[model samples]
Target chain A: MTPIHAPDVLISEVGPRDGLQSVSGTMSTAAKCLWIDALAAAGLREIEVASFVPPKLLPQMADAAQVVQHALRHTHITVMALVPNLRGAETALRSGARKITLPISASQAHCLANVRKTREDMVAELRAVVALRDAIAPGVPVEAAISTAFGCTLQGQVPEDDVLRLAVACAEAGASDVGLSDTTGMGNPAQTTRLFKRLFQEIGERTGAAHMHNTRGLGLANCLAAYEVGVRTFDSSLGGLGGCPYAPGASGNVVTEDLVFMFEAMGVSTGIDWPTLMAAREPLKAGLPGETLYGMTPEAGLPKGWRG
Target chain B: MTPIHAPDVLISEVGPRDGLQSVSGTMSTAAKCLWIDALAAAGLREIEVASFVPPKLLPQMADAAQVVQHALRHTHITVMALVPNLRGAETALRSGARKITLPISASQAHCLANVRKTREDMVAELRAVVALRDAIAPGVPVEAAISTAFGCTLQGQVPEDDVLRLAVACAEAGASDVGLSDTTGMGNPAQTTRLFKRLFQEIGERTGAAHMHNTRGLGLANCLAAYEVGVRTFDSSLGGLGGCPYAPGASGNVVTEDLVFMFEAMGVSTGIDWPTLMAAREPLKAGLPGETLYGMTPEAGLPKGWRG
Candidate 1:
């Protein structure tokens, strides 16, 4: 792999998409746009603006296309959108998303339950999506997110070999990068270290961002484990939002403020400032009132004399 | 260090001392004892039960002696207490604490502001405490916890040499072990890795627990970094309780439930079951009404099919 000038870690904020979606009240399209702009001003280089899923399925994401278009206006940051399947991918590309994330569940049961498809079928769908993206938008990055790469709640104890197989399959199917997700937040540091090591070893540099849930509270720990093993880009929802609906109150994604705080405070250039990013929360909270937001950094106030 | 059976990691629950003290309300002695017992029942081996400061200083910890007595009932678990000075050490010994932790601030400004003593004076106090513990309870462990080991909120960017010197001085002063604390919560994974590596290299096996906070939200990230470099015994709080009075909300120690979940999910044998441990939250939360209780594992329901 070429030595990238980017710092050792990259915290990709998924608040606009994962976080907002989990919130009960919907943010106005204008509000969403403001939050995105605020985040960019806060020095976040990458942000998952929205998912191109069916608006009927998730009304909260009804204005995703508009958000993506606005995010694309700021060319400095990479604009990412989540695509549940081929149709979602098409919507994301049409809306000008430079990067499209495809979710492929590692657990067949989760694949069946979450998106109503078997694991193999999802892989085939991802292959089709990869082909479609390559044909329609060649330079655009295509990521096959192997969801539940860590143990899954639907199907307990996903085999490491199975996760690796799906990752290889995703790569073979033409994904530009293969990411891993701890959909259930059941990851531990040892498992995190071992799995990421195996992933990097087997998949080589094809490993992508770690899309982890804070459900079991290992979000940051799992992220650190991934970082230690050479995975840089991490997908975290602001306020730790976007928990599994099946697990209410669990949807809090690893709070972006906290995640950025964790990385930046340690002197890792996440390219984010805690105070500025924390200030961004006001717009977000304004967008979706009556939401139960969570994050220790913003509430705790910055350490004694902490700087950006 | 003896070659004892090293389970994947060590999670020291600091909710009683570090977690509760950070919050505004004080848990009743009975409530504190109940929570400590619940944590011990959940397979926590080491727990920081209470601080030994004077009642006049931290009224929340006035019932420290009673809590200590309650924690001592569990033979399998080791009871630890925090002390700010020699007087506190005296209190700790009288309470029959098996482990006494002294916070020795690395930042001179933090030392003066926090403990009202200089780093050198803290070291002298640690020496005296060690002597007291040795004389009164030979088998009891005495640890000098170097706070702001990574950086300080009061004095930004504490010198590495200063931290190392403090650790060395504490060891020379007869401390049984030396621990590092991110008092200001200004720790990142890389810095955590480097600081721990340096401490272990400088202090060798004398290095103790990784005392961290979620202030800037890198608690687990820092913990993982420490674990990667061979440091064991992480200090955490149950429900991520305990906000520092001085640094309101800044005291959310690493959440114990989340820490255990992270470890156990990684197959690290924390000997803690998430469900049972989470059950302790209700009682803990009920003890302090209106206080914000923080914990990912408690809020996020356990993953679908976890055995432990």
Candidate 2:
């Protein structure tokens, strides 16, 4: 009924979009809404509810607009969507999403494979998306995330200089905020800390979330590295959903529950109830039956009297 | 073979002792030797080869002396053993252990549950062990690990002042080094960094290894926090072998393979060969048939051209 104090850190839940898209089977539109509503009920202030991609390309997200519409009902949540280009951006804007995130690959090989666009081409597309958003839904923040900014499976070691240059390009192209993503989960804490420090030096307050992956089990550590260097926003998925489905035992975003546990346990406010956050996993499992959910906290449970 | 440069960090392999003892089924003595040989061949310089305990308490460690003898054959490795008290220490010293580690629980509740001794009683036991070591093996190091120094399962939060006081007591009792152990995996990075910092201030160079567990999935993060605060030695179980079996999905030490990967990828010299370390798991699995081996780096193959 009343306003809750803003959490010391902002954890944007990207499970519905990133997790669902990576899976082969499509979760029903109603089930996705239920999951999204469950995440918001657990006190997540932001949720990337959908991705506006064509049905033919990704049938998992064919009901993206409906998911966005349903999530918009949570007045306390900033409903966000991801887009690959200006066309998807137009659709996302019309769907009444409050925030938009555009993915631009730092590794040229990954960019070409995912979107068939060069780095320069993607930046130009980002500029176009920002312009379109200004013309229609003014004040809707557009964020650019540099994917594979840590390293790429194709390129092996992504150059740090290249990542910094591309981040500046996103900022110059009018992205309200720019973030670094370990899309391949090849990042180490040292690199995560260094890159974020350099990103802040280059872009100042324009730096956004640290979207780390647990592919190598260093996700939470990398988040700690980023936080030590002044990162305040993080993007994680519920149940450690989504990943390079191509690689066995690899997953995309860090588990939201575990990340929340690490920060909240350390006396950092995440504004989410630990028990309630753990309970939200049921809706996710219900929506996507038989999927192997990953998270040590969920499996091990919290320490005795962790809340007390 | 020419001498290899010492690694920047030391990874003390504790699986043969901690991991084997926790499981219900016993690994054959020959199999334990084979596993220890593999770990040494992979460049692990120190291995906690066995726990010198009574056969009735843990049949898995029934062949403690034989395993320690086999591990000693490596010559390069510091064959360490865990001793509960003066009796185990006398046997371990007679068997030629290069180092001895005594577990002194910081939490009174854990101390009572584990050794049926109070914290002060454990400190007195440690003093006796150190005295015996000096008479029989003067040069050998006697380390005391303050388990549950971070938090305890039976008794909610363990006070920081209490942990610091225990470390001081261990140092005063002639522990060659005093380290912190997150026996319950309830530690967070902030708590880890703060506690280790205070420990360093109190004991200086006497600070020992950080034995972090992955129960709540913050193991690596906690290790990083300790490392950042100047604690170098780390205790880990290969494949995350040991854990709290009472709680489903709970785990013990940080996975050595993944810990090696984190440091190596960050350009920190672990001195251990990555591929060889991964291969070592085969012998462990062979030894403990049907046991679930855990590690993400082994599950997700290394990044392309990571060696290059």
Candidate 3:
């Protein structure tokens, strides 16, 4: 199959949701809104603003509805939220989320640990969530992000067949899109390319973002391998804020600044204003004091004659 | 040209040389010998042991001759040293270094700043050094490492043609091999692949190790790109020591642990025993009390079921 080289790639910012959720401190709703607005202004077309879950369980995302309400004001950006079940999906849709992602673990152990349900049970929950979306919010799109699609910290070595089977189940369950995630960051570039190529072959147009972690320092390499196999949308975080609780000492998502620099330097436009995207980090830093923000490009400055 | 997929790729450890040279702390010859012994025990076949430079200029490498002599005790490991000129090359050969690498900056500004000489003057120096190796130490191999081959902090955007021309000059100057060094860590994978492919076309089998830095966090990605283009022999530092002094805030050489993990996970053999290689870091840490060490694989541990 020929590799798809798109003129522009979509960099979906997930810092507010994924970045904040994993950290200890809770960002204020107002601070979250400012961060979201800065991201939007930096030409990010998609932003996963919040996750719909009980405030008691995750106080970090307690202001999910408020954050979503504010993010929806930027009509140009796709306001996204994470949902665990039908109730969360309903809440997300009601809060004006254009996109809702449901995470289904390919590894049974991770599935049990993360959502307190079996993989089959999670698929059933996804089916219910999709049904609710179609019934009450037919226009809103629900995407199933297959977590531990690469490997699992609990079970380890999640088979490719299991991941493909789960993805097919999600597609068959009325979900609009399916994405593969390296939740444990146990992916090598070769494995990333092979799995993503198979994903495109199986799910075709339903294949979505590549959510790779920098836990083992293969995040960007894995992303590049996926891109080489025609996967365009990439999920990344500003400052690489979120760490993998499963993989000790492993960093969080791929840093957005470095990713943008890679694509832009290669002559592939990400449509992000370089200076503006970098400026967005200021508010993020202000909101999360004492948190160690990680990004190489921001620290190293741009290369000589770099206009991006 | 077909990409070379060697059963075993050489991991040329540059920690004792590049790692020590860049950092402020000076490691004693005894500590250096312990680190070298551990590296050899880990199955590393080759290591850049030290730099043959004036002690007054770099007190970090004051025991260069002692380090090289101690490293030579391991008959299985090839002792290598960096040489800046014919004088250093002679010193390295007399000290029983099997291999000597001379760095030639591709960027004129970097060449001036690093060695206080123009590019043309450096080419002349390489010629003299190669001649000295041929005359005095006929068995010792000489390699010219084109530093800042990617780009430069002082003179950003080193032209591809200039780099190719320099490689040709070094090859013509009787250097046994010519390698590319991302001295400023300004390389992306695309540029890396493009440049290395061109190098093979120009120099053929004379193309040597790819010395990539983890400065902008694209070190492993850049190495993968070079490997994909048929280049073999990677130069990396244990625990990711040796930051680019030219590029502020840039990290160090590609982490040896992370690089090994990448290739080993992809079914590419690195020969080095995983646990033994990680154990080598203990000596490195003990030698430098306050210096910061880096490597994701050491921190994250090995993936489940990893035998190597």
- Among these predictions, the greatest lDDT belongs to 2
Higher-scoring candidate on TM-score, 1 or 3: 3
Task: List the candidate numbers ranked by DockQ, top first.
Answer: 2, 1, 3
Candidate 3 chain A lDDT trough over 10 residues, lowest sum: A243-252
Which 10-residue span in candidate 2 chain A carries the lowest summed lDDT?
A243-252
Candidate 2 docking quality: incorrect, acceptable, medium or high = medium
- Could you give candidate 2's per-residue lDDT for residues B1-308 as a string of tens digits? 11267677899999999888777668999999999999999999989999998989888888888888888999999999999988999999989999999999999999999999999999999999999988999999999999999889889899999999999999999999998999888999999999989989999999999998888888899989988998889999998888542134455679998888888887777778777888899999998888878877887878876867
Q: Per-residue lDDT for B135 in model 3?
A: 83
lDDT string for model 1 (B63-165, tens) is: 8898899899999888999889998899889889988889889999989998999999988888888888878888898989999887876678887888988
Over the full model, what C-alpha lDDT does candidate 2 score relative to the true structure? 0.88
- Candidate 3: global Cα-lDDT? 0.86
After superposition, which runs of candidate 2 have C-alpha atoms over 4 Å from their true positions?
A: A1-4, A243-249, B1-4, B243-249
Best-fitting candidate, scored by DockQ? 2
TM-score of each: 0.87, 0.97, 0.95
What local distance difference test score does each model get? Answer: 0.78, 0.88, 0.86
* CA error at residue A308 for candidate 1, angstroms: 8.4
lDDT of 1 by residue, A181-202 (tens): 8777677767777777887887
User: In model 1, which regions exceed 4 Å deviation?
Assistant: A1-9, A60-67, A241-249, A273-279, B1-10, B19-36, B59-77, B133-136, B244-248, B273-292
Worst 10-residue lDDT window, candidate 1 chain A: A243-252
TM-score winner: 2
